[model samples]
Target: MERRPRRRLLLHGLVGLALLLADLPALASSLAAWRITRQGALELRTSPNVSLQAFFEAGTRLRGPRVWVDLPGAPSRTRSIRGSGDVREVRIGRPTPDTTRLVLEFRPGTELNPADLRLVGTAADRWRMDLRGLSRPVLLGLGEGDIEGSATVAYSPPAPFPTSGAPLSADGLPVVPRDRFKVVIDPGHGGPDPGAVGIGGLRETDVVLDVSLQVARLLQARGVQVVMTRTSEVDVDLPPRVALANRVGADVFVSVHANALSMARPDVNGIETFYFSSSSSRRLAGSLQGQMLAVSPGSPDRGVKAGRFFVIRRTVMPSALVEMGFVTGGLDSPRLANPAHRRRLALALAAGVLQYLGGR
Candidate 1:
């Protein structure tokens, strides 16, 4: 009987050993063998101050089930860096035992295009994540794809622009000026709020203001009454800007802004437009998008989208926000920095407005 008990214990121990041997594969796979580092953080002095980066050793296959961009200024109490341009902090964490996530925080008034993130494999065993070519706060994450596909896939523009139906009634129709049409033109981010800073220290406010003024002049030449939110360099709040459009009872409202994307992909250049995600604004948005593309032949067609921007949302009439070109783009930056290119952008904006108003 004593021998039987001893044999029983031996069998149990053998079973446990066998199970552990069988689990060796899984245990080995789960081991955190990959080396990760924030090595790119040292090069934060570059323009737009691409302040942070994460690097992973080769063979560390990444699979993200959740990736996104968080635009609210960095969490107030979290670990952070101050005044390194638009980016405030880069936080890394293990949301789960097996998952590692990188979160980028930005200062207020910064923006990021998820597609601008460029993940490059620098060596046989090293991959680098770069954050550059941007002057705004943007959040980007990767999910369910190879590294390259992850970020670009996040920028899924709408497939098609919606068309407008017949005008329901005279009261519902866009207002027409006695002689032609009237429009409210808003140049976004002025004075203190520089909106987005791009390559060679080009400020979004300066570019947009210049374009807005030129658009105003072009519209006036075509017999359209143009009411500008701010005629010169000055700060204009969102509420007051919308209030001016509503007060004038303009037929249509158009806000101008220059686009900024992640510095990693300086090649991403294009023009895009946003209207409220409502059917009422689609037709105008579509017209503007189509006309602008027609004038700028080589520019990438980013398509019209429904955005919940304050100015467009608050305005009573049909409204659209125009993102002329990428100020951080290699091709677009030089073009926008030049006076002739600014005039072309102005012409495109004016033409789009005129087309939507049936003035073209």
Candidate 2:
């Protein structure tokens, strides 16, 4: 009887100790692993891939200026990855017990928007911070592009650096083209996603699709192979749209949308073209914006902007999101409603693509 009691006590002690040991790591914030993965560009992913687990508790504010986190408790030493792409190295710093910051050092002229840097959940306990827009410092060489068919072929960054070979554009930078340049055109809203409703009850989905189809036709006629995310008014999820463009190895991706301002401020209207924060993407956007402005000389030019929209951000090609006109703006609404105007916009967009493609 004595021996039995002693054994039970020992087992209980061991179990309690094990539990305590397990809880120890949890007491201090645990950062599992920091690793890099690449699609067309490199991204830093946290182990367990979720948000900083216990490190950042509730009320922990994610302060900007630069990415710094104020946690409930102190975390381990800062984690670092040496220079890659636009990132010289990304450091997770705990300068003080309650304050932690993610310090990203970028090379000169590398544009980084707070909106572009994000923590996206990848798995049950995992999340990924995609920095593709800010940097693609290295290319592992192009994947075999010989695979037949657009649905099967996946295009990658050419082995040469993005700025290495090819004819200089008007801006005087080398832009290499795949064997056959391909373009993906995404119509903004479809199916149940009617987008913005404006004067005379205009449906954004219908108007955008009509204009997108026209754009596709013009590009196709110009001998530039074109892929449409949807030809009919059917709902297409954003992921699949991006996947289609990536799978086909698109040279350029353009998402067409019509703008809508507040009902109260119906007068705010113009053409705004957005690109991811990259020189190539910005060049593409500028080209398109210029062409649109030239064609619609009377329309207000909202100018080229930068954004991390899903279609443009995810696609590993020169991509842009074009907002043709404001459906709610009294001056622009009537023009967007006109079929001729839509056609002209399509032609202008096609011209922009051609210009970006070395006027081919």
For model 1, what is the C-alpha lDDT against the true structure?
0.53
Q: Could you tell me the TM-score of candidate 2?
A: 0.51
TM-score for all models, in order of appearance: 0.50, 0.51
Number of backbone-clashing residue pairs for each candidate, in the order shown: 7, 9
At residue 220, give the lDDT of candidate 2.
56
lDDT by residue for model 1 (257-331), tens:
888987677889998889996665787888778866766768899889988888888889999998888889887
Give residue 22's lDDT in candidate 1 (0 to 100): 8
How high a TM-score does candidate 1 get?
0.50
Off by over 4 Å in 1: 1-180
What number of backbone clashes does candidate 2 have, counting pairs of residues 3 or more apart or in separate chains?
Answer: 9
